[model samples]
Target: MKKIAMTVFLSTAMILTLPISSHAGHANHQPQESKELLYQDMLMLFLLPHIDQAVHDFYAKQLTASPVVYPYQVEVKKAERVGGSRSFHFLITLETTPVVGPHIPVGTDRLRFEIDPTLPGQVKLIQFEHLKSHELPPRWRHMIRRPEAIR
Candidate 1:
C-alpha cells in the first residue's frame, strides 16, 4: 500500500512540475504543444491511474518464489493517438526481478483503449494482449490463452 501511494505521489509530483520545468528556457512565453504531443500527453494522463493496477496484475500472474519485488519496470514502446481521435494504442513492456530468485519477466503487452476526448478519465479497454508467456512461479494458476486470441 505504501509503495502504491509513493508511486502515485511521485508520478503526480512529476506531472505537476512538468509545466514549470518546460518554462526554464522560455520564461516569458508560454510553450504550445504540438498536436501529436498534446495527444500523447493526454493519453499518458489517462493511463496514470491505471498504470499501478496494470503492474500489480502483471506481477500477480507472474508467480515467483518470493514476494516478487514491488514496483516493476514499465517501458512505453508506443503510444498512438489513433488518427486524430481519442482512441489510443499502446505497446508496453513490463518486467520484474525477483529479490531472491531468478526473474520471471512479464514480457511485453499491447493495449488499445478508447476514451471520450472530452473526458479522458473514462477509458474502455478495447484490447489487451500479453506478447508472450513467462516462467511459472511457485504456485501460479496457469491459464493458457487461446491461440486465436493471441493475435
Candidate 2:
C-alpha cells in the first residue's frame, strides 16, 4: 500500500513540473515570431523598391573608387512607420583594409533615410549626417535630387 502511494506522489510531481518546463521553452520562442513580424513589416514598407537595382549599381562604382572608405554592407537597423511615411535608419559599415602596423580597423558614416510612401518611389535623403564625403557618388548625386533644390 505504501509503495502505491509513493508511485502516485512521484507521478503527480513529474506531471506538474512538465508544464512549467514546457512553458519556459515556449516563452523563449515567442520573441522570435514577433521579430519576424517586425522584419516583414519593414520589408513591405521600406525595402520594396524597384529602384534599388540602380542604387546598388551606383554604390558598386563608388566603392570601387574608394574601397577603403565606402560602405561594404548597408543594414537597416530600424524602420518606424509614421502616418504615410516610413523612416529607415541604416547602419553602413565601411570595410577598411588591413594595416601594416598595429592599426585597428574602424567604420564611419552611418546614414538615415526617410521615405514617404504617399510619393510612391520618391525617397528623400532626409539626413546624411556622420558622413565625411569628399564628393558624393556620381550615380546617387545625379539620380536623387535634394528636396530643397526642387523649384
Candidate 3:
C-alpha cells in the first residue's frame, strides 16, 4: 500500500510539471529573420514616394550655407513595419566644426529625426522639448519642417 501510494504521487507530480517545462521551451524559440527584412522593405516604400523636391531643396540650402558641416551622419534607431508600411526613428549627429579664432571652440549637436511610412524616405525633425535651450543654426531649423509644410 505504501509503495503504491508513493508511485501515484510521483506520477501526478511529473504530469503537472510537464506542461510548465514545455511552455518554457516554447519561449526560447527564435523569431523569424524575415520580419526585419520585411520592415526594411516597408520603410523604403513609404519614404521613396514621399521624399520630394522640397525636401531636397531644404537640404541643399543648408549645404550651401554651411558647406563645412553640410553632411550629417544618420543613424536609424528603430524601424517597424505595420499594415504594409514602415516607420522609422533615427538620430542625426552633426559633425563638429573645427575650432577657429582665438576664443571660439568647436561644438557638437545631436538631433532626432522621425520618418513615418505615410511620408516615406522623408524625415521630419522633432523638437527636443527637453532640450529647449539648445541653439541650432537657422538652416538646421528650416530643414526641420514636416514634409507637407516643406514648400
Candidate with maximal lDDT? 1
Residue pairs with colliding backbones in model 3 are 46-120, 47-120, 47-121
- TM of each candidate vs. truth: 0.35, 0.29, 0.24
lDDT of candidate 1 over 39-64, digit per residue (tens): 65564655645654554465454432
Give the clashing pairs for model 2: none
Q: What would the per-residue lDDT of candidate 3 be over residues 105-141, giving only the tens digit for each residue?
A: 2233333345544554457654221211223444354
Q: Rank the candidates by lDDT, best first.
A: 1, 2, 3
True-structure Cα RMSD, model 1:
19.9
> Per-residue CA lDDT of candidate 2, range 1-151, in tens?
9999999999999998885434345544644458766764564345324223323333343433212222223444555655544454332221122111122221233444555554545554444333333333344344223423211
Instruction: State how far residue 121 of model 1 sits from its true place (Å).
Output: 5.1
lDDT of 1: 0.48
Q: Which regions of candidate 3 are displaced past 4 Å?
A: 1-67, 70-105, 128-151
* Model 3: lDDT to the true structure: 0.38
